[model samples]
Target: MTFAATVLTLYPEMFPGPLGVSLAGRALSEGAWSLDTVQIRDFATDRHRTVDDTPAGGGAGMVLKPDILAAAIDHAREKQPAAPVLAMTPRGAPITQARIRELAAGPGVTLLCGRFEGFDERIFAGREVEEVSLADIVLSGGEPAALAILDACIRLLPGVMGAASSGIEESFEEGLLEYPHYTRPPEWEGRTIPEVLRSGDHAKIAAWRKQRSEDDTRLRRPDLWERRGGARAQSASGARHEDRDQGQ
Candidate 1:
């Protein structure tokens, strides 16, 4: 299982430092995954390593030359033919846990980080690239967004986490938020840990966790609840069908 990522950017040095310190870092060192950075400037034509130019129609910042970026991506694709080329931009689809899971389950991926005024729109129009965004706000560059995505996907790889179920139990796995957690020193500042947690009764703890998760979702993100109505309906229908079969 070779999980690899290629990042296209002028600032290749920005990576590996942050990505090198965590689970992703360990994965790279242990050969479970790989990350390669391609300097877009290396593909420039001029003597000065010029990868950006003035916009065709006049703009505030220089635009990344499409040909240069394209060459960089092509080079990476040649090395890893199975990698998916993704461009980071505020105009792209919103990144979510589901998307991260989808990417992690794939062979590999390539991240294109844009700088200056951003890449020529033609790159997005012509290339087979998926545009992704971290949030509604804009960042100085795509490096941060690319790193954010890399971190999310790498941790989901098998063996990267200590427990396989840790990823599933995390928030958004069940269409509801996760229940609150408590640690040692059951009593703190006049507050006591929930009795269900300390009861040592597994069945009661499980029920309490489920109910708390639902309640947290309702309070924090009611939008997930609205979207989950279809799933809930399907579950009800399945239960009714099973009941009828048992009666027969």
Candidate 2:
């Protein structure tokens, strides 16, 4: 089945921008996935195409009009029924690799790219929308974040990537960061590829990569290492280290 993705945004042209250039683009062209954009402003009921309004009580930035946003979401649903709706917001759950993998395995997604200060709380309350944030920091708008999310999902679709192992060994896939990769010249400016990788013994190479992935994760992303049941993984990695030493 061709995965279907619909994006609702004030700036519809911004879409299929970066997504049209890489693996996402290739998948899109190959019918592995499809994309369509809905202009939120098109749902406005005013001459000026106003989609936002002043804050209810007192706030510096304007809020997206609830009615207008609801209409846009409804329109998106018409085209891609059953697709889960996600609103890009700074005050949402951070987007994670697991979430991307889940979405990639599903039919598709309907993304609502929020702008201005944000949508009226009613938009979320009245609709079954999942709030997703790219990071802890804020952005000028949700479009960029949405693009990133789509790109991530697109790359995970079957056959989109050249190597299946590429997906399996990435950071967060095994509760550890990926080991360093080296290529070409075998020698750089005073640097060279690790000897084990050059040794051509698959077992030893795998063991080296495993230990590096564990150590790097523990050092660079202690937060992830801790969250993903790090102790068990560390123990497993330690066992392997011992086995490698015994074989040596």
Query: Whose lDDT is greatest here?
Result: 2
Residue 124 shift from truth in candidate 2, angstroms: 1.5
| Candidate 1 structure quality by residue, lDDT tens digits, 1-248 | 96888899888999876889768889889977898889999999889999888989775889888898888888988998887898998989988899889889998789999888888888877678899889898999999999999998899998998999889987888888899999989899989999989999999999999999888888888888776777899999999999999994
Error of 2 at 36 (Å): 0.6
Where is model 1 more than 4 Å wrong at Cα?
A: 230-248
Residues 1-248 of candidate 2: C-alpha lDDT, one tens digit per residue: 77888999988899799888778888898999999999999999989999998998997999999899999999988887878999999999999898998899889999999888998998889999999999998999999998999988889889999999888988878778999999989999989999999999999999999999989988998897787675678888999999999995
In model 1, the clashing pairs are none
lDDT of 2 at 234: 82
Cα lDDT computed for each candidate against the true fold: 0.88, 0.90
Candidate 2: residue 142 lDDT (0-100): 90
Please provide TM-scores, in order, for all candidate models, with all chains considered together. 0.89, 0.90
